[model samples]
Target: MSKSVLVVLSEYGYWAEELVGPLEALDEAGYRVDFATPTGKRPVPIGVSLDPEYVDPPLGRSVTTAEMADKGRRLDASSRLDDPINLAAWLPDRPYRSEPDFLRRQEEYFRALAAELSKADRYDALLIVGGSGPIVDLANNGRLHELILHFYRTGKPIAAECYGVACLAFARDQENRRSIIDGKHVTGHCIEYDYKDGTGFEGTDFVIGPPPYPLEYILRDATGPDGAYIGNFGRETSVIVDYPFITGRSTPDSRLTGDKLVEVLDKGLRTWGFVPRTGVVAPEPAAAGDR
Candidate 1:
C-alpha cells in the first residue's frame, strides 16, 4: 500500500526548493501528501525562492535554477493550497488548571485530545518544511509540538529540513520536559550557512540582521551528550535517519531527506550519518544528482 505523509509549512514564508524538492521525490514514490499551516491561511513561498536570477544575500549568487523556479511558481499558483488543514482549528487548545472543574475537565479534555491526536495515525510520516518562515512560527508552536509528539510516540518517521529542524529540537513532553530529539542523532542548518543580514519574514516589514537564534547551536544543545549533531557543512549533502527522526542539513539535502524517509518506511532502514553502536550498518539510498 502507498504511504501517506503530513507536510507542515510555515505561514511566514518557505523556500520554494525546500518544499518542491521533497515533494517531487514523494510524488515519484507515489506517496499521498497533506499540507498544513499554523493558521488556515495558505502558505506562500519567499519571493526570492521563485526567482531564478535572485541572488542569495548570504551566498552572493543565484541559487535557484530556472526549472525549480518554474515548478515553485506553478505550485504556488495552484488551488491545492487553498484548503490546507488549519492547525489552530484542528489541534486541541490547552486548558488551564485554574479553571472550574480543573481535574475532571482536564481528564475529559485529555481523553478528547488523545482522540484528536490519533488522527496522525492516518499518516505514515510527518515532514516539516524549512525556510526563514519556520523560524517565526513553526519553531516554537505548541500545537506543532503536540503534533510532533503524536508522531514520535507512535514511532512514525519525522523528517525536518533547514530551520524546520528547530521544531524537533523544541518538541518536548510536559512530564520530562525533554526535547523529542534529546537523544537522537540529527542534522540541520549549519553555522557556516547562516545569513549575515537581511533575514526577515514575508508579509512583514521588519528585517533582522541574522536569524533570531542560531539553529546549529540549538541543535547541538538539544541533542545533549549522548546524541550528536552533524553539520557536514561543506559536504555535498547531509541526511540522517536515526529511527523515527530523519533530519536534513539544508536545502541541498531536501530530496535526499525524502528518499531516506521512504527507505525508513520501505526497507526498515534504521540509522545513517553517524556510526551505530549496534555494528549493523544502515543501507544507503540510491545515488542521485545533487539538487
Candidate 2:
C-alpha cells in the first residue's frame, strides 16, 4: 500500500510556508497526504506574504513571497479561506457535543486525527505542521489530546513544527501519562522572537493560552522544572527530536524537518512490516570468519 500521511494544521492562518513547504516535499516523495484543520475547513495562511510584520519590509517579504508563490501557489489560489471539512466525517466526533465553536472546531481536528489513527494499518506515518493558528486551535483542546494520545499509543512517527509542538503538551496516555516530549529535548519559536519586539500583538492575536501566552513559558510549565532541554540562545534554533516526537522551531527548518520525518517514518515502517526490495541491504552474515 502507498504510504499515507495526515497533515494537521491550524485554521486561522499565518506562516503558510511552514506547512506548505513540508507538504510539497511529502507530496513529491510520493506519499499520500491529507489536510485537516481545527474546524475541518480549508486552512488559510495566517498572514499575507506582503504583510509588513510577516517579513522584513524589503528583503524578507519579497523572498518569502517568491518562495511561497513558487511552492504553495495552489494553497494561495484556493479561494475558500474558510473551506470546511466534515469533522463528523471522522469517527471521534460522534462522542462530542457540536455547539460551541471552539468545541466543535477541536472535535473536528481530533476526529480527523482519530480517523487517521484508525487507518494505522494502512498508513505509514503522521506529520503535524505548526503555525500561528495552532496556538488558537490546536493547543489546550481536549480533542487534540485525544488525537495525540492515539498516535502516542500506536508508537508512530509524529512530526510537529513551530506551534505544532503545543499539541504534545495536550497528549496524555491511558494512565493519564504526559507525552514523551514533556521531558525531552525540544524547541520551537524562541521566546526572544516573541519578546524581541517587546510587543505582545503576536500572542494576543495568535496562540492558545491564558494572558501572557508564550510557547517557551508554557513549555517550561509543561516540563515541570528540570526537564532535560535547552533553547534560544543568541541565534535561532529549529527542529528538535525526543524519541517518537519530532519538532521544528519555524520555517527555516522546514526542509530538514521533512527529511528527518521521512527518516523516522521509514524506520517505523521497517519495524512494522515493510522491507525494502531494492537499495543497499545489510549483507546477510557472510562466512562466520569472513570478517
Candidate 1 residue-wise lDDT, 1-291, digit = tens: 899999999989999889998898889989999999998789999988889888877667887899989999999999877878999888776678899888888788778779889887999999999999999999999899999999998889999999999999999998898988877788999988898998878889878998989999999999887787888765668888888999998777887888888888888998877676432223433374356
Clash count in backbone of candidate 2: 10
Worst 10 residues of 2 by lDDT: 271-280
The candidate 1 region of ten consecutive residues with least summed lDDT is 277-286
Candidates in order: C-alpha RMSD to true structure: 2.5, 10.1
Off by over 4 Å in 1: 96-105, 277-289
Positional deviation of 162 in candidate 2, in angstroms?
0.9
Flag regions of model 2 displaced more than 4 Å.
Answer: 49-65, 78-85, 88-117, 174-177, 195-212, 224-227, 235-237, 267-291
**What Cα-based lDDT does every candidate model obtain?**
0.87, 0.57
What CA RMSD would candidate 1 show?
A: 2.5
Top-scoring candidate (lDDT): 1
Q: What CA RMSD would candidate 2 show?
A: 10.1
